[model samples]
Target: MDQVTAAFDATPRRDFLPRAVRRRASYDGPLGIAAGQTNSQPRTVDDMLRLLDVRAGQRVLDVGAGSGWTTALLAHLVGPAGSVLGVELEPELVSFGSGNLARTDRPWASIRQAEPGVLGDADGAPYDRILVSAMADALPVALVDQLADDGVLVVPVDGTMLRVTNPGAVVTAHGRYRFVPLR
Candidate 1:
């Protein structure tokens, strides 16, 4: 089985969700989380992760980290040698997500409140992989610049799931996907 799939089995989705929706964790559709955000459908997240091709020791950035589900999964994928930084916009979710992440005892992964009017964590640039759960109207040049020389980013842009590699910033569309607009 693929590493992403293995990660899914290792990290229970219900652990990262709000109590009200924990029973619905196995549902294929997206579930509501704090601050009107969705945790994203499992299938979509799996697709994004497979496209990203995250390695065991690559540093990853998870934009729109929502409930820190993806962050914890990324931490599992990277193992102890890597780290993951998840940034979320809503303060409520920030606190909620932070607490969820803490339960996993994965010190290498953390969710932080996103800065006002800022995109990803700029200070932690040069990420080996970036996964954006929100949708953008167009390619976010700012995020592409955050990539390391050979980094990869999986994002939803204009309804299309795009796998973008650094260097030339090559982009390939996977399929159509719906997501909350990027703030």
Candidate 2:
């Protein structure tokens, strides 16, 4: 298995899912989580996680945290010295994500609810990596602005998976991917 799949196996996406959502764990389709949002597919989540290129001691921001699976994975990838913040637009999702993340062994992972479209928690500025879970037309400027000078931003843009590293260089996949639209 590739590193992403290995990570998934290590983390077990099922463990992060709520009881109501566990049945859809292997569906590879979006499933409802807390609030009105849906958790992203495991394959897509894996792809994004690979593109993130997370390293130990880096801070990560997970936009549209949903059930907190992606956040948990990132927290594991970055290890204990690194911190991860899962931000959701709905307060209830924030609570749900927190509960889900609490089960993980990583103590550096946490959830924060904020207005949709806003990027990093201003209080937690300068993230080394940012992963936007929901689909979007383009990289939100605010999110790009929040990146640490050496950071990386991974998102789906223009029907393709793209990575935007600090200094504004964009590397897009030659293929297209379908995802739930960004709110």
Candidate 3:
């Protein structure tokens, strides 16, 4: 439970979650968010965040942000000097997530609905880290190119593989991660 405690201390998962979901947040089961998608459980979130190796003062792009739970966590991880841009495909869902973020005291969190599979606001290019919450059959080349030269991109590929891409490097691993498929 150390990881879970760390995440909760850094960012209250319940704060990013919808009121309805706050009641069900756990590491054992999937929790639904807006747009018919679900937030991976607490343990999953911890694992993914660990894999991303996010640090303070690093700009992060949260692709397929559901209720902005992970985005909020990134905001906390990056602190006030850094920013997190949450891009989702459904406008209403984006609005919902944005609203959730707006209620937070954190100042570096923001959300936008965009064409699916896109990353970072074009205006906010070259993020230090990119975390795609949803899985895809293949890595989205666009996201890799959006990364800063030394940036990291963590994506779940082929629905069962986790791939981390960086300049001159690409790594993949097989795993059972339950996430809404990236569109």
Candidate 4:
């Protein structure tokens, strides 16, 4: 099995969800969380992670980390040597996601509130792998700029999923997808 599948097995989605929605953890579809956000669908998350092709010991930034589920999964794929930073726009989700992340043994991963009007964690730029769970009408140049040389960024743009590779910026379309618009 691939490492992404292993991460899913090791990190349960239900752990990141509120108790009210835990029963629907296996639903495969997105579930509503606080601040009117949704935990991304499992299949979509898997696809994004696969496209990211994360390696061990690489730094990753997770955009729109609604529940910290994908953040934890990325942490698992990167292993102990790597680190993951999950930034969320919603204050409620920041606390909720951070709390869920704290339950895991992946000390290298963390969730924090995103700064208003910021596209991504520029202060923590040059991320080896970046996973964006939100949709943007246009490809976010700011995020692409934050990628390290040869870094990979998987994001949804204008309802289509895109895999962006740095150091030349090769872009490939995966398929149609839906997510909350990037703030």
Among these predictions, the greatest lDDT belongs to: 4
Q: What is the per-residue lDDT of model 2 for residues 98-162, given as tens digits with 9 covering 90 to 100?
A: 88888887889988877765565767788899998777887677777888988898887668887
Name the lDDT of candidate 4.
0.94
Which scores greater on TM-score, model 1 or model 3? 1
lDDT of 2 at 29: 74
lDDT of each residue in 1-183, candidate 1, tens digit only:
889889999889999898999999999989999777999999999988999999999899999989889999999999989999999999998898899999988899999999978999779899999999999999999999999999999999999999999789999999999999999
Clashing pairs in 3: none
The 0-to-1 C-alpha lDDT of every candidate, in the order given, reads 0.93, 0.80, 0.77, 0.94
Q: Which run of 10 residues does model 3 get worst, by summed lDDT?
A: 1-10
Top-down lDDT ranking = 4, 1, 2, 3
Q: List the residue pairs that clash in candidate 1.
A: none
Q: What total of clashing residue pairs does each candidate reach?
A: 0, 0, 0, 0
Better of 1 and 2 by lDDT: 1
Query: Among all windows of ten consecutive residues in candidate 1, which has the lowest summed lDDT?
Result: 115-124
Which residue ranges in model 1 land beyond 4 Å of their true spot?
A: none
Query: Model 2 Cα displacement at 53 (Å)?
Result: 0.8
